[model samples]
Target: MSVVASMGRKEKAQGAEPSIAPLIELAGPDMERVNALILDMAGSNADMIPEIARHLIDSGGKRLRPLLTLAAAKAFGYEGDNHVKLAASVEFMHTATLLHDDVVDESEMRRGKLSARMLWGNQASVLVGDYLLGQAFRMMVEVGSLDALRVLSDAAAVIAEGEVMQLAAAKNIETEEAAYLRVINAKTAALFAAACEVGPIIAGSAPEMRAAYSAYGTNLGLAFQLVDDALDYGGSSMTLGKRVGDDFREGKVTLPVVLAIRAGDARERAFWKRTIEDGAIEDGDLDRAIGLLRAHGAIAETVSRAKAYGEAAVAALSATPAGPYRDALVGVVAFCVSRVS
Candidate 1:
C-alpha cells in the first residue's frame, strides 16, 4: 500500500487519529523529557489552573510542533538539555494558542472532547491560556539562548497577529487567497518555523542551516494548514475531532471557500453571502457547500498547492545534515499533506 493507505489503515486499526508516529518514534528519548517537563510546568496550587491547563494539554492532538524542535536538535547532533526546555516551551505556546482559539471561535468541541471553554468558561480558559504563555516565556528564558528567545517570542507575536487577522477576515466574503495564506502563515506556520529554528540555534548550527530549517518548517506549516482546511470539509468527524463543516458554520473563509467564492456565479455568490457572510445557514447548506467546492475543484486545488509547499519543505532540507532525522523530517511533510487521501 501507499503511505496514505498505510496510514489510513493504521488509524482505523488503532481507532485513533492519523499520527506522525515515525517522527515521534525517532525522537522518543527526547520527547520523554519534553513530556516530563510539560507535566512539571503544568502543576499549580491554584487547582483550577492546572486542571484547565491539563484538560487541553492532555488532548489527543499530536505534539507535532515540539517534535519538530526535538527532531531538529537531534538532526544537528545536539547533546544538551536545552532542547528539552525549548521543546517544552514550544508545546506550551501551542497549547496556549489552542485554548485561546477555542474561546475566540466559540468552539464547542476540540480534539474529540468538549472544549475547555465549554467545561470551565471563557474567562477561565483565557486566564489559563495566559498562564501557559507566562510559563512558556519562563522556559524560553531558562534555555538562556537570546537568539532562541527572540525567535519564539517573535512567533508568539505573529501568532496573536494572525488570530486577529483571521478574526477580521471572518465572514468577509471578499477575503482574498493571499490574505488567507498570510493568516495561516502567521497563525500556524510561524510557530512551526520557530520550533524548528530554535533547535538548530541551540545546537550551534550555522546560520545557513538555521535558515534552511526555518524555510522547511514554514513551507511544511503552510501545507499542513491547507490540508487541515480541506479536511474540515472532506474529512470525518473522527478524523477532525470536531464536526466537519465547523468552518462553514463559523463563516470562516479558508482557501477552498475563497476559491469557491471567486468562481461562483450570481446565484452561487448569493448563496455564499447569505450562508457565509450573513450566517443565514439552513439544512442541506453544508452538502451544497461541498458541492460548490467540488464543482470548482477547490479541494483538489488546495491539496495541489499543499503538495507544492511540501516539495519546498523537502527542498529546504538540502543543507540539513543527511541522516535518519533528516529523512524523517521529509516524511513529516509527506504525512502532513497525505491526510486528505
Candidate 2:
C-alpha cells in the first residue's frame, strides 16, 4: 500500500501504530529550549524583519532538523547549553533557506499556506531571509566553537551552491542522476549532516563518533528527500503539505522523473520535453507523468533507493553507545523511510 493509504487506515482505525511521538517526547525538554531561543532570536529592532521571520518560523513544521541536533547532544550526554544555541542556529538557517527558496522557485504556497513572498512582496521576503542568515551566524558565533562554526558555515556555502546548481539543472530533462544526487546532497543532506555533527563536537566526543553521527544524518537526509520526491507525485496535499505534483509543475528534475525519463521511449521522451523542458503542460499531464513513472517502476525503485539509504543511516549508529537517545535516533530513521510506507 502507498504511504498515504497506510496512514489513512491507521488514522481511521483503532490500535494504530505510533508515529514520531516517541522521538518528539525524548527531545521535548531541549526542544522547548530550542523553541524559546528561536523566538527570542527572531525578535529584532526592525518590526517588519521579526514579522516576516515569525510568519514562516511559527508555521506548523516538525522542527526535525533542530530536534536532531538536540537528540544527538542528549544521546552523548552533553552538559552545556551550547546545543541550544546550535539548534536554534540550525533552525534559523533552515528557515532562511525556505524563504529564499520560495522566492527562487516562484512558489505560491508553503506549508499549505500562502508563501511569504505571496503575502509580503518578494523583496521583503529576500531581505528577511538575509536577516535570518545574519541571526544564524550570530547564534553560531555565540556558541564559540570554531569546529562547529566551520561545519555549519561550510554547509551554508554548499547549500547556496547547490541552489545555483539546481537552478542550472531546472527544466533540463537530460540532467543526469549523479548530478541530481549532487544537488540533493548539497541542498538537503549537508545541513542534516552538519546539524548532527555539531552535537558530538559540542559534547567533546572523539572524531570517529562525530563522523558516525554525520554519516547517519547524511544518509537519513537522502532517504528523506527521496521520499518527499516520490510523495510529490503519489501523495495527497493533506499528506504532502504543498499540492501534489508541485515538483512536476516547477519542472524540477527529481530522482523519480530522472529514472522514468531514462527508461522512457521516444514518445515518452517527447512528452517529457514538451512538459518539463518546454513548460507546455496541459490538464492531465501530471496524471500522464505519474502513469509513466509507475509504468517504468520508477516510484518503487526510488523508494527502494531510499530504503537503502535508510539502512545505511541505521548502520552508522552501530558505534554509538546504546541508550534511549540512540534508540530514538534509530526510530527516526524508521520514521524517515516510513513516510513512503
Candidate 3:
C-alpha cells in the first residue's frame, strides 16, 4: 500500500499529457473571472503592504485554492458572481499564509524566488500579510454570506494555531503522529475545506453535497501535504524549486522521516538522532537518509497513507453527480500526489 502504488487511477495519463490538464481544461472557462477577482482582491492601499503582498503572487503559484472553489461550484451548478468573490477571498487568505509562513519558517526562497520577508524584511512581510488578511475579510463581507465569512474566519484562526504548533514542534524528534495531524489539519486542510465548501455554500447546494466537497478538499489537502513531507525528505531539491533537505535541516518531522524513525534500524536511528534530533548531520547525510527511507519501506508506507487519503478524496466525489467537473476533481488529487513523487 505504498502511496504511489495504491492510487487507483489508470496509468499512461501520466505519459505525454500532464495529469492535471483535465482539471486545468475543465477550469479554463472560469480562469478569466478568477484572475480578475484575484487582482481586485490583491490590489490594496498600504504604505508597503502591496510590495510585500505582490512578491509571492508574482512568483506564480498555481492558484489551486481558487480553482478548487470554481470546480466545486461548477459541479453543483453555481452560476453566480458571489462564487468569484469567495474564490478570490480564498486565494488572498492562502497568499497571506505563505507570507507569514516564510517569516515563521525563516525561509529564504519561495516558488523559486526570494521570499517577501527576504525582499521586504520580516516587519514588512508580517504587516503586509495582515493587510492581505484584512482585505480578504473585506471581500468575504462583500460577498454578503455569513456562512462563508464564518468559514474563512475560522479557517484563518485554525491556520494560525497550526503555524504556532509547528513552530513549537520544530527540532523535537519525538513529535507524535497525532501532533502532525493536528498541525496539518489546521495549517493545510482548513483552507482547503473552506475553498471547496465556499463553492457549495454559494451554490446553495444540499447539505450532503456541501459536506462531500468539504471532505473531498480536506482529504486532498492531507494527501497534498503528505506528498510534500515525503518530497522534502525524498525529492531532488532543484527539481522541487527549493533547496533539498530543508525539513531535515530545520528538524521538521515530515512523514517519511517519521516513519523511518519508527521503522529504521540502529544506523537509521543514529541518522535521525544526528540529523534530526541532534541537528548535526553533515554533507551526504540527506542522501543517506533518503537511501534508508527507500530501503526500509518508510517512504512507501508514507505514500500509501497519502494514496488512501487520495482514494477518500475520490470517493468523496461520489456524492456529486457524474460530470466532467467531478472527474477532474478526482484527477487533481492523483496529480497532486504524482507531481510531487
All candidates: CA RMSD in angstroms?
3.4, 3.2, 2.3
Candidate 3 lDDT at 23 equals 72
- lDDT of each residue in 25-61, candidate 3, tens digit only: 8778786787776666666666466566666777876
TM-score of predicted structure 2: 0.95
**Cα RMSD of predicted structure 3:** 2.3
TM per candidate: 0.94, 0.95, 0.92
Q: What is the alpha-carbon lDDT of model 3 when measured against the actual structure?
A: 0.80
lDDT of each: 0.91, 0.89, 0.80
Give the least accurate 10-residue stretch of model 3, judged by summed lDDT.
1-10
Tens-digit lDDT string for candidate 2 (11-115) = 447664536677799889988998888889888888888888888877688998998999888889998999999999999999999999999999998889889
lDDT for 11 in candidate 1 is 61
Candidate 1, residues 1-341: lDDT per residue as tens digits? 24334544666688765447778889999889899999999899999998987888787888999999999998999999999999999999999999999999999999989999999999999999999999999999998999999999999999999999999999999999999999999999999999999989999999999999999999999999999899999999987889999999999999999999999899999999999999999999999999999999999899888878887888899877999898778778767866886
Candidate 1 Cα outliers beyond 4 Å, as residue runs: 1-19
